[model samples]
Target: MTLASTLLWGVAHLAAERRRTGLALMVAHVLMLAGVLTVFTAFSVDLLSLAVQPRWLIVLTVALVVIALAWTGVIVWSFLLVRPPRSDTVGRLLTTTLTIALCALVLAPTAYGARLAYVSRDVVNSLFSTTSSTPVVAEDPWSGAERVNFLLVGADAAPGRPGVRTDSMTVASVDTETGATTLFGLPRNLEQVRFPAGPARDRFPGGFTGSVPDTPGLLNEVFQYAEDHPDMVPGVQKGKRGPALLKQTIGDILGLPVNYYAMVDMKGFAELVDAMGGVKVTIEDPIVYGRSREGLLPPGTRKLTGEQALWYGRSRTDSDDYVRMGRQKCLLNAVAKQADPMTVLNSFERLAAATKRAISTDLPQELLPAAVDLAQRVKDTRIRSLSFVPPLINTAYPDWSQIRRKVSEALSHRPSTRSATAGRPRSPERTPEAPVSLDATCR
Candidate 1:
């Protein structure tokens, strides 16, 4: 419905409800919900997002919540603070009417603020997100490489934590000519990588904070030691936090340059999946883990909710992060497969209502449609992924030594985004892109 129509309907419904029952519980709740929807729909970036994280749209929500709560509180406080005056019926009605009007007063500012915040965030993201690598595109880079590599990072928001831990790491390689995408998962717990010595340890027997000088087989201990001792000087700042630092750490690892970076503030992922009608992920093994948000998930292909999907990607219960990396890949595939552009467009009216409140991306508005189309074209396409976990990459016997080695390899290997793709071996048929006019069997 048009924003106007929806608002009119909500106002009419609220009026009728008030007439039937003054401040009745159900009546107030119904009105509140209607008002929320109307307001949210009125300010969404694109109505096509209902199939995604539509419900928690930030701007309108922040506005409406403040107004709604304030209204309720005021009405209750007024009743408690004073006796109903010998006021006429008209007076009471007028008071209630005025309160309702004030509640709705949040609409304009809420929407305006939400849009501003959304655009502002994108600006910040673009400014800070330096191209770690060239973008993977349909055409080959002049370097003559067919594959393009992109990095995925799982960042935590815990205060005092060193920037972001490379908890979940994955790399995707796309062959522009063949339309194939392969993903590699890197285990965060890989052995031998030296932990960045917080400021406290900079003067230690080792070297600088991030230097890997002789810190073999004791990688975990470094972080543990740094974490355990806040008294240490290098350890000041309560833990090195700052997202950009961790991005550097990852760039230090895989040897390939990174181009595009996406950081989902730890919440948007799960909500986004469910908002997209849930994803269909194939479970390699049974997941018995449970959380308040996501319950039990069996070992087969199943639809997942936001919390459930989050738990599935992030949970390290029975398995290590290496295994979880695999699960993360599955979830990514599922969401991409389930992206029903048609459903999204059809429900644009409602979905647009929901988009503003819940999610933001580094991609620009002009880029979104193209990204959507690009994602859609690759939909249902088969993808394969690899993870250089444990023995394949980290051969250190002790976890710490192994961690250091892994860290070194990660840093040494870390380079440009395209270099990583160049590092990978592709079938001879997987040459650079051939023009559409070229014969398919020209090879």
Candidate 2:
């Protein structure tokens, strides 16, 4: 925390990494300290312009961050000290100077990293509905003011992995003044979602629909349906129409005009978890093995691989897809909860590479830095949780008539249909199908 403690830790970590530390190392460390000052002073001014701290606190925080950077920089130099002779006195001085200069050079990467992170957020946001992004749509008809709603959807449709399913879906609603961000899971099953763009009557099946196509196949089905019945899922191009319909469907349900969307491919999710040193999740139930992806998932707090994690998110054999949707929502929360900002920072390059390779977003590029800034400040209390899996599907009594009743009630923002029948989980009921209209979803 203090400068001395930071310096000591830096030296100690260096020593631990390398058996030896000499005058050259010491000099390198000092230069590292200076280099940190130079780089951070330059970057923080640009990245953190919207700090809420009082003037004094802001100044103090900046000072501390610079010190931390210096400490971190010293850690980098420590690696060199462990190596064989970095150089003679003159050589060491030259090497130290060179390393310092390298830090200056590395600043480019930091700025570049900032830019990449910014772009990533923007792209994801923009991807939701290209026309505009009004992500915060939250309103409890029972409550006074309208709530903020954010359309959160994860499509496996990233390039190269086209026709992938909607692996994750949730509507995030926040009370603007109160800053209560409630996340609700949208059951992949449910049924009809009229799209605004291509098909005016596009339909997204509920996850539990036993005969409905898998996500991958469903993607094609939607596209084909769009091709044949474009009015059903409006705003869809026949060639790659599924994504368009799906996006529209998601937009309609959230109530908040659809603004931003983020799609993470299978590889991206796994790598992101691993990149964050794996998320620590408290698994409450035992995940049984299943086909299509018979992943061996052990219950408890264990690190999940790509497939294992996917299956974990997708597993609903016991409770069906509704519960699975809840689990996926938890995984997202866990990912954000356990997310290592530093790891994300340090691995910005890696994350960026993965971002381009495995994610697609439509958010404007410039809004990125602000998003990261907002994200950094958002503590757990600011977030709330909800589920789109209506109470009807929670049990076996979800007959078509009952299910349709639930869907209608949901659209009208009324109480769930199954409250009188099936047991209710302590979750806000989200209609099975609430896709966005093309006008509201995109532009």
Candidate 3:
């Protein structure tokens, strides 16, 4: 009778002649079931919406613990009330042991679910606390917004380096409704970068000029530059002043409002890749790295380790930054597509730890639900890319007018169809124009 109750939730109580208790348990079970069904029906299309809400996560965690305790208590009470009164000593011992085992089996998954929820809340709090300065719209985060622009940067703060340098910079402008994303890649060596209206503009009227001739002013140095001179951006918070400056400068360069910035430390980035079980990438050619050019990853479709994938994306020995940019795009696409829910959930703890260690952003926690929903939508669509490399634009003396025009054109048009040149190296003779589909290019 107790075992049956574990399945039906109230069978044992009725069998034990407890009419009131049996009816109450059955009603509670039915009500819980109905609530679950209603919630699932409402959020079936966007299940990630629930996961992203910290309040719901906490509530669910507590509810699971309560459910486990109540269920186990009922199981014990039911067994005591319904057990055979004239059973032998050995039979009683056997039944008691079996009941204990059954309770453990029921508690196992419930406990695990609670643990995951707690860990998720911890990570969310650590990364996206309400301490952020950016204002969030409570009801609709994306209302009246045609496009939301984010600055995604990869900064390298190596062992011996004095300060961090943002070597990889990409602006992702996403359409609010369609989830159509356009990625604009800027070379690290791009010089004469302008700043928007701020103290930074007051200091650098003629664009960013390096303090020293040997360390020429370039796009990559913007972060450390702001850090070194905090007086220039006094309104910004202390630790994040650098990224704030870079965000404004990049926004000015693109002629778009860079709404948020997410930066990942290059050193910790390897751990993130490993946490996701490493990313599968298609290599088109041999890439070399290291001070002595000792490391080489050959061409093929391969699942790369953290270190290998880092080199594959960052190395510029035989190739230049432009080629490296394309490879980075391909690697990002692979990680985004391949890191499915099962893999992430299985390795969630490690992924969360690595993410918190590596990434820094200004986005508020309240916006995470909307961000998660948008990400799910983005996964279903194609991503487009525009690289500002040599021949297309001169890094030394870039035309700000032409750069903005190209950006406007790319944003205005639909992404191109799959080209025969997808996954192939760009030909020197090929015409330099327009954004190409990232899916086709990475495929």
Candidate 4:
């Protein structure tokens, strides 16, 4: 009877013939059940808003603790009432054991819920704890922006490397209403990148230049260049100066304001993929990448482990940077579409740990709910991609005006006049040559 009280709340009291107490407890149980149902229904409707709020998370934590304590107290009281007053020692032991088991069952879920809430709060605070010193393009939480542009960077700073390199740079421009997105890929070797009007412009009036035979003066070198010349980005923190310069340079190149940047360290990126249980991609040819270019990843459509996936997207052996860019885009699409809610939930802690170590951004904590909402919208719509490579635009002497015009046309939301894979041999894993839906591009 006392064990039955775990669900009935008053079973032990009723069995002990305490009619008034039993009836009162039963009424309280019914009220609590109804309240829980109502709260859950509301929670489902406003989940995005509520989940990201630290105060709301605290409230949820406290509520679970209180419920666990109160419910267990009632169980113990009911056990005491129903236990025989003159019972033998063996009977007392059995009854006590049963009560302990009942209490354990009640407390387990409550404990897990509280921990999950606490972890979520910690992650949000750690990821988005922006200070007044951090420079921002917008103060509001995305209230009136027609389109928001985010600079996505892949920083390669291997263990023995001297400095970080901006190996993979892409801009994701997302439509506020329709969730349509256009990805602009810039080659790492893009030279003669013009700096915007500022200290950098004054320093490099004739555009960024590098040594002829030694250095290519590639766009990727800009990050470390800013770091080396801290005076170029005065008043900014040492870690942030590189990204600040990149944002300005990329924004100028694309003819759009770069709102915020999210950079992932390539070394730690492998860990993130592993945490998500690897990424699935179609490999048309074998890829070779390692310390001495010894490791090889074979061809096929399969789920790749962290190291294999990294090589698949970035391998340069017997291939060019332009081909690698297409593979990287496909990898992005696969991760976006395959990482469902249940997979995330099951691997929540590992994923959170990997993300904290692998990624950094200037996004504010207050904008998390809005960002999450935007991500859901983006998932439902089509994503278009365009890369500035040879024939489209020269990397050594890029036509800035033509690049800007292409960006404008892509964002105009007009129908694409050219076929996505036009004028190019169709490979099994090739990304569309022109701006088009990723669905048609990715396998």
- Model 2 global lDDT (CA atoms, 0 to 1): 0.49
TM, every model: 0.45, 0.54, 0.90, 0.87
Candidate closer to the true structure by TM-score (higher is better), 3 or 4? 3
lDDT of 4 by residue, 1-443 (tens): 78788787888888888888888888998898888998778666467667887888999899889989989998899889877566577888899899999899989989988888888888778777645343334443565566799999998876665688898999999876557778899999998889999998898888987445656678998888888788889998898899999999999999999988999887678887898899888888888867687777788889988888778877888999988888888887788778887888777888888888888888777666677778877877767788888878889889999998788767765332234433323324323343432323778
lDDT by residue (316-341, candidate 3, tens digit) is: 88888888888887887788888898
Error of 1 at 116 (Å): 16
The model with the greater TM-score, 2 or 4, is 4
Candidate no. 2 TM-score: 0.54
Cα lDDT computed for each candidate against the true fold: 0.46, 0.49, 0.81, 0.81
Task: Point out where model 1 deviates above 4 Å.
Answer: 1-147, 157-164, 175-180, 194-248, 291-295, 299-301, 346-382, 395-443
Q: After superposing candidate 2 on the true structure, give the runs of residues whose Cα lies further than 4 Å from its correct spot.
A: 1-148, 156-162, 176-178, 193-199, 202-244, 251-256, 289-295, 373-380, 390-443
Task: Give each model's clash number.
Answer: 54, 58, 0, 0
Q: Give the TM-score of candidate 4.
A: 0.87
TM-score winner between 1 and 2, please give it: 2
Clashing pairs in 3: none
Tell me the tens digit of each residue's lDDT in model 2 across 58-120. Answer: 454555556546655764555354433644677667655655655555455555544554554
